[model samples]
Target: MERAAEAAREGNAQYFLNLGDDELIKLCQKRDEDGRSLLHSAVVGGNMHLVQLLVERCGNERINSQDSEGWTPLTSAVSCGFEEIVKYLLSLGADPNSTNAQNRTPLHYAASKGRVPIIKLLIEAGAKTNTKDIAGWLPLHRAASAGRAEALRELLLHTSKPLINARDISGSTPLLLAASGGHQAAAVLLAAKGADVEAEDKDGQTPLGAAAPHGQLRDALVALATGEKTLDDFEN
Candidate 1:
């Protein structure tokens, strides 16, 4: 299996092709000692051609089949922000909500990377915005914590009525996460969406309090101070 993977990495398309359907099935079905498959190899290679071929031969259910790390082929594609590969996987009915060992969905990957197109694609496909990971962090929480302004915007546009003030298991709302990360744009957006800038968590830290120490949070502070209108009002 490592040899086949190395072959793919070295661009030995012919060797991969010659591995035979029977052999390919064996490898794709036979989890390595590491629990990885030939499909996993194709995904790691990010070879769109190989991925398509693997899908055509192995089918979509196998496309999501995971290795030891619980990473599906779609997970690999999204992690690298491979837009077309992700699209193809989704077209084949790949599970948008599938979580790895960390409990992160593909939306989380796109949000964390600030990949707008992929983020939009996932949202349009009905990816849940509020899915929690092992850390109880949702895609919104990740976008806020990572300061991914564009990702947050795409999400807001899609989820017009999203729980802007919904707290994670840590009791941190999107506003608090954004402010804590010093993401002015995200914080402002959250506040404008009716995030309770003054809402305190178990620790008694408001979004405003979270932003207090960060100079970059000034615009967000002002937005929170003055943004009294409901976030839903801004929806088109």
Candidate 2:
């Protein structure tokens, strides 16, 4: 098992290159103490050849198999920001909505890392943009809080207006998260996308209130909130 993991992780195909079919099956069946299979390590290693070899030679059941952390190959690829691997997995029927231990999907990870192209691929592959994690944070919330403006825009392209104003379990909207995180660009983008700036969190703080510590951000949100200015004003 260790040897298999090592080969998969280091992109060393020699370990499995000449192995017999039965040997390959036994190796693929074994998991590390962490419950990660060779496929998991192969995805983490970013070796497309190994991935193809395993999935094609073995079977598809392991494609969505979760380790102890509940991560599938699709989830791992998205986490590592490997577009080609993600695309390959999706093309081979990997679930776009696969979730990990935190109930966070591939879209959630892509949004947080600001993987714009990956974000588009995941959404196009049928990833749900509004699915919440364990914290009730949606992909939109993740992008906004992480200040991923382009990723957020990609998500917005598939979101409904009601979802645009959706709040998390903490009652924080994407705009509120952006403002609290001092992401002026994200805050502006959210507002322009129809986010309710007047929306409040559990603390009774609106987006403008959340941006109070950042003078420029606060003023920008305030102007947009009151219709005194538009994002176009700044962009123009």
Candidate 3:
């Protein structure tokens, strides 16, 4: 099993080829100490050829298999911004909405990293835009919190009607999260998209109120809350 994992990490295609058909099958079925299959190792290593070989042998059932962390190979690929690997995994029938232990899908990973191409692929592959993680954070929440302005824009454009002001477990809307994270661009985008800049979190802190102390764009946030300057003004 260790050899198989090592082969995957090194992208050693001939190692599997040298083994008999049944032996290769057994190797493909093996999991590492961390409960990750050869497919997981391949994806993690960004070894596209190894990934292709493993998927060809093990099929889509293995593609959707989760590791100890509940992360599918698709999720792993997405998190690392491996665009080609993500596309290949999806082509092999990997579920775009497959979740990790935190219930964060590939879209959440892509959104967090601002991987717009990967996000588009996942959405096109039927990932629900409003899907929530264990923390009740939607992909928009992740994008906003990470200050992924382009990813946020892509998400809003893809969804039929995004919950612009949807609250998470902490009662923090996307706007509040952006403001709390000091992500001025994201905050401005959310506000322009009709997020309630005045909406409070569980602590009753408005976006402006929450951002005042630590936010780099405190003045911009203040103007946004007061409607003194609109998103269009910033865009222009």
The total of clashing pairs for model 2 equals: 0
lDDT per residue as tens, model 2, 1-236:
98789889998877788888899988888889989999999999998888888887777678888889989889999999989999999998899998889999999999999999999898888999879998889999999999998888888888887888788888999999999999988999888767887888888989878889999988887788788888798678
Once model 1 is optimally superposed onto the true structure by TM-score, how far is the C-alpha of residue 58 displaced, in angstroms? 3.5
Best by lDDT: 2
On TM-score, the leading prediction is 2
Which residue segments of model 2 deviate by more than 4 Å?
none
**All candidates' lDDT scores?**
0.77, 0.88, 0.86
Give the clashing pairs for model 2: none
> What lDDT tens digits, residue by residue, belong to model 3 across residues 173-210?
88898888888788888887778878888888888787
TM-score of each: 0.88, 0.96, 0.92
> What's the distance in Å from true for residue 157, model 3?
1.1
Q: Which stretches of candidate 3 lie over 4 Å from their true place?
A: 160-162, 214-216, 225-227
Which residue ranges in model 1 land beyond 4 Å of their true spot? 9-11, 160-162, 227-236
Give me candidate 2's TM-score against the actual structure: 0.96
Clash totals in order: 0, 0, 0
Reference-based lDDT, residue 41, model 2 = 94
